[model samples]
Target: MAMIKTYRRDDDGVLHYREAWSEKSGVRTHMGAVGTKGRTRFHSTRSRTWPDKPTATEFLDNFTEESAADGYFPVPDDDHGWLVLQCWTFTADLSHPDDQRLFEHGQDALDEHLGWRGVGHYDGNDLGGKPPAGYDLDGTVMNLFCKVVDTGLGVKVVRSFARAFHLTPYHVIATREPGDDNDYVLAWSPRKRDKDFDLFRL
Candidate 1:
């Protein structure tokens, strides 16, 4: 999945938004007033004159820096008073080599983003008979973390975060079981079969 970032600025009380993301062809950006149709442009790494940015990821990283320097700030996660969910992933089940690769890829893709929180492990045994809070059954693994930025988009952020691991939305587990809509979990398993990715209900 492509990684996206949104920036905002106010000029004389008028608000504008700018969004940038890494795409298959290169870097894409959109900018306009908050409620209007935006203008977009694409830049190819080789075709553009960005001397220091040779990769889409590098281009996006620099784009973010330049946006900040230009007085454009990241849109506030709770701008609309939405409950900002602090979400984290369970460690990937690393019994399969593919799972390890997916976990690493997701981590690397998200670690630098502003929404990324810190990662740590919970002592599953210490949770008083509760299972470890992660994808891996083993409780000792480190969890990757992120927040539900743009909660108004309703899970888009979470889905993109999961897609980085080659996992789909079905792999997401919420912090609350059954009916409660809460945080997210990225599920994984050593079993390669699709059925093994089923959401585990606590």
Candidate 2:
């Protein structure tokens, strides 16, 4: 699960958000999600207002829904723009005081984004009890992860398993990185099936 630093605005309709991350020393750096929310004034170029205090799923849904009112994620943007479903796949011992909350928001922000999109859909005995309080969810896996990403992005995560075409709930996984069977990262893309590099508009 890739941790995403989503950008948001303040209550006054000023964009302000911060990404909570864990560093190598287990220390964290809560950088502004949009950077310098203070210096920028409200009479600004952009203003984001989030009512209902929507969760992650709701956040993405609201964006798409609002766009649909105008009509759809906004072209290659909604459909093809970088969904960037991010996460960190590190083996950290958060039991340390400093590290405790360093990566703590990882789950919070993650659950918020995915839940708001009505994703986090889980139905299996493997669930390790219910999600703790103050959080929108608890469990984590590939399939459940997909529901959140695909719903938010409005596109299908295509994978193998011919009979089960839409089986790739996790379009992108935090595998140190996504690569071919040989574990090569340089040659990856949505067009995994072909070599048609149209993203640059050649």
Best by TM-score: 1
- Provide backbone clash counts, one per model: 2, 20
* Global Cα lDDT for candidate 2: 0.27
- TM-scores for all candidates: the values are 0.37, 0.21
Report per-prediction Cα RMSD to one decimal.
11.7, 17.9
- Those runs of model 1 whose alpha carbons end farther than 4 Å from true positions after fitting are 46-53, 82-202
Q: Tell me how far the alpha carbon of residue 55 in candidate 2 is from the true structure, in angstroms, after superposition.
A: 25
| Candidate number with greatest lDDT | 1
Q: Write the per-residue lDDT of candidate 1 for residues 1-202, one digit (tens) a residue.
A: 4655554546576555566777775787877654344577978874456555468777777877887877777644444212212222232344454445545554555443213321111111111121334343432233333343333222444344455445532233222222235333323333344232112233
Q: Evaluate all candidate structures by whole-model CA lDDT and list the values in order.
A: 0.43, 0.27
Give the poorly placed runs of model 2, Cα more than 4 Å off. 1-92, 95-98, 117-146, 149-202
lDDT tens readout by residue for model 2, 1-202: 2132333334675333333232322222233322122221111111255333434443444444543453222212222112222211112233543324324443344444333332221121111122222333222321112222232221222112111332222123211122223221212333355332121111
